[model samples]
Target: MITKSIKGIGKAVGVMLLIIFGVQHVEAQQFFSYSQYMNNLTPLNSAYSLIDKNGTLNALLRKQWTGIEGSPSTFIFNGNLPIESINGAAGLIVMNDQFAVEHLTEINGFFAKGIQLGNNQFLGVSLNAGIRRYVANYSSLDAVDPQFRNDVRENKPNIGFGILYYSDHYYVGVSLPELSIRDLGNASTQRADFFRNHFNFAGAYLFGKEGDDVRAKPAVLATYTKGVPFIADMSTTLYFKSILGIGVNYRTNNEMSGIISISSDIIKLGYSYQFGTSATNLGGRLSNATHEVTLSYRFGQNTMSRSIL
Candidate 1:
């Protein structure tokens, strides 16, 4: 009986150690990315508006590792409008992200223009301007510590650009959605090694005729940031009669996601659930499941298949 009690106590100590180290790693991660990224590409590349020429409004909410205090939570809004005469599109993106003692908000507006390269082929470029505000309530952690006496706060200007080559069936793009000349500030939390620029590259292809009962889309996105390993996401979605979608995604970090959506001509709703596949996974104990929901409205175009996105 004593041996069993000791074993149980040992496990408890191991778990506490895991939580301490794990939470710090979570704080280091940038949680802006989402599981339903394909539903709204504006955050990654505003130029995607070039191919999808519809007046669009989309909102998304995501909660990561449910039940964990200070886990990441995000809210995003984006709207895009098309200008047929200029072969261009304009859009706005706003996001709020909070985790641990840090909170960040960004607002950006962008314009993209596409030039015809050949039959049904086009190349597009985009430019965006924005402000990023970061505030960390370090003082809340320990009011008695001198280092935590002052909270960190900074507002910085940002500019970014994206380029894409697209047609009716497939598209590929690369973008730096947030570029800033000034740093967040001189805090240990703002380690330059981890606070560098982010790069995004993605591509997608659709298969099947417009009238087909079933269609498939395959997509891949790769992201790189300093002091982090390259992360890649690969997904395949199947759409039925352009009304219902079911998909699965795999991330390089051994994370798996399941997605589903229901759509009409004017509105669409989507949800995704994500979890790690590892035995000692964040989804199991360090945190919990990740949940994301997306809602979108589009007008002026239902002529194009949803796969085009």
Candidate 2:
């Protein structure tokens, strides 16, 4: 009798986990998202590798749903530089994410070449190639279901492409962050294929004079997945003498965030605090809040001293 009761509980847990996985896999972006995309753009759009004329190194750490167990956490690092000789730019991006029973890692290399459109205006196209590693740890479950007793790991290849148009004060970009799909392996004979085909568009505009005491910058980022509704994010930031900044972000009923940042000639530090406002109870129950931090360093000369916030 005890054996039968334990088996029933295990099955119940397995079913619950399956439902959660299905919902997340289908409704959300497969890749980890950072609120500070403006600070570190390479992870989202390869074409952004050349945003700065000089080489740039950036790192971001994000903790999502602070009070929730098995919540997602991400670490990303990227560096990019312009090759004036070739009229191109190149970058390297590495990201790792952990959530629930799954962990993912990706390493990508980006190359882009641009042509001068006019004074301070340019157009560029970029390509990214990478390998993705995914692993599921079912052994960690307290009561392992018989159907999910087997552990799974997959290593796959992915490629992406992007285009960007930018001038001294404004920029626009479009990209496909992932181009390949992988089977997540079955849990209890249920097909759980990984979602694929994500499209992203981002743009920003800067408002100020050559020596303005303050400036206002507005930016927007939108994403589309194959089967999910579109996700849009908009933000506006105010900068004081290009040194300190404050901003707010709105995510279409999903979240609202407050941003604060400080910058100098070579280093930048930023932080964002997000509040959940989704109509769904899951957003309120599972997610307490989201926090993200970004740090970046610029090498070589400081040709342009503007904040991308």
Candidate 3:
């Protein structure tokens, strides 16, 4: 019964983990899920940089299970420079994810270019190259135990690509953001499959006319990785004159979140809170709430203020 309870707890945590965790021998690495993905999608799709005509820098932090020691946390810093000359954009993206005694950090640089396919339709493609480092200090958990005596550390090169078709009001795209070329550590190719090749499919539509005081946008993002079920996020946000935003997201795992933001022409601040349904409750053993915050700065000439997506 104790083992069953532990398994239940692990499954509950997995629903929102987004990133990977490692036991002594199992290699599990996945992508991070942020409630405010609609704002900064560069982490998911490099091509998203093309949406903004201006130079933008964004910083985001996500803290899960607040108050718990060594709980999951993530930080991302992203910058984009739009090149109208070639209808392309260049950017840098850096992300760090930590949980328990495990840490993963990746730094990447990307280039994206677009072309006009029709009168108003455009298509874009992007490529990213980076390095990923993973460290697991198992001995910290239980030094005396043989299983936890040794630590695991691995470094691997990372490559990713994205394609997007977009216009003014709506867009759709697909991307493979983490493609691992080789296995890591002692884990064989099959065991290491969990760490590589994550695909993201996303799209969004905007509602309301141009210059409208109020507008609404709905977005859908789905992710697929080996050894896990398809994960999806559905969200709808209401924008008030491009100054304030309020939205909610529901994941296929039954996790839900509420988001709010306030912004100006040069700066923006956003927040999100996530919780689980009663079906996945932990009976107060752990905090069921997660908090995320984001700050962004935009400069250069504004072609359309900000992207609706």
Worst 10 residues of 1 by lDDT: 186-195
- Per residue, candidate 1 scores C-alpha lDDT tens digits across 72-132 of 7899999989998999999899999876677888899999999999999999999999988
Q: Over all chains combined, what TM-score does candidate 1 have? A: 0.88
> All candidates' lDDT scores?
0.79, 0.76, 0.79
The residue-by-residue lDDT of candidate 2 on 34-146, one tens digit each, is 77776566788878877677888899998876765666789999998889787788989999987667777889999988878899899988999998877776655533457
- Write the candidate numbers in order of decreasing lDDT: 1, 3, 2
Residue pairs clashing, model 2: none
Q: Judge candidate 3 at residue 239 and give its lDDT.
A: 94
Candidate 3's displacement at residue 173, Å, is 0.3
Q: Which residue runs of candidate 3 sit more than 4 Å off their true CA positions?
A: 1-30, 187-194, 281-285
TM-score of each: 0.88, 0.86, 0.87
lDDT assessment of candidate 2: 0.76
**Judged by TM-score relative to the true structure, which candidate is superior, 1 or 2?**
1
Candidate 1 lDDT (Cα, 0 to 1): 0.79
Q: Give Cα distance to truth, residue 168, candidate 1, Å.
A: 1.1
